[model samples]
Target: MKQICAFLVIILLTSCEYFNVKKTSSEAILNEELETFNWNDVDEYPSFSSCDSVSSKQEKKQCFTDILTGHIFEYLQDEIIIVTQDINDTIDLKLQISNTGEITLLESDVDSLTVKEIPNINDLLVRSLDTLPKIFPAIKRGQQVTTEFKLPIIIGVD
Candidate 1:
């Protein structure tokens, strides 16, 4: 009887652990989820009203780029630009789109030669952005998020 009681006690002690519930705080779970979440990518790209009906992610992105670059190109073409020397260069236009859908020029990577050839190039880019259609901000995890983009604008003039 003594040996049987000791065996039952050991079984009960070990089995108690199975019934115990481990409590996890909400904050801890949220922190863990955030740690594993990818920060570099967005669920949805910023879009124009024209791009709203696009179904695929890649297509949406392409539509956004096409519309944006087309507007800037058209704006630049509308302006009369003349250069002393034959100029051919690519300007990396860094732009930031706020969560509220406002666009701002963060920086323009213009080479000294390009600057010398076209002093108002930066102004032209800024003015072109000012003419952009109303933008819908990028979406990440169902929340509107600010995003930055580097757009390459080619400048060629004879």
Candidate 2:
């Protein structure tokens, strides 16, 4: 009878261990150790915490740094133009926009980049920002730090 009682006691004690819903420190440690660290996420894009609420100019500057660091522009392959037309009526044309605000009509791959455009379009630059003119004029904090941009376009000969 004593042997059966001791066996029942052992079973009860072992079964109680399964009822533990609380996460132990040791368990957390083990889980963290087992998880594989994602280096690419760190090396590639900026984290939400780091990139969030970029309201101030300083924050924008930091965001720009993170953007360039991540090389987010590397994969951006913007087509100059997209047209669906018959070969007999189709023609090839090329256009380019420079940060200098120049709406250049480029004929050759090698062209001068020093020539300045009208409004001096720079980073996040566009030829005619319909929204920008209505929203924010020239963003001047301390001094003018000119940034450059390039946009290419292709048009049909017809």
- Taking every candidate in turn, the Cα RMSD to the unseen true structure, in Å, is 1.7, 15.5
lDDT, model 1, position 115:
93
Best by lDDT: 1
* Least well predicted 10-residue stretch by lDDT in candidate 2: 130-139
Tens-digit lDDT string for candidate 2 (34-149): 58643222222222234446666556545644443233222212323222432121111133323232333333222122112211212212222212111111122332222322
Candidate 1 global lDDT: 0.94
Q: What's the TM-score of each model vs. the native?
A: 0.90, 0.21
Which portions of model 1 show Cα errors greater than 4 Å?
A: none
* Pairs clashing within candidate 2: 80-154, 99-149, 100-117
Give the alpha carbon lDDT tens digit for every residue of 1-158 in model 1.
99999999999999999999999999999999999999889999999999988999999999999999899999999999988999888889899999999999999999898899889999999999999999999999999999999998888888
Candidate 1, pairs of clashing residues:
none
What TM-score, to 2 decimals, does candidate 2 have? 0.21
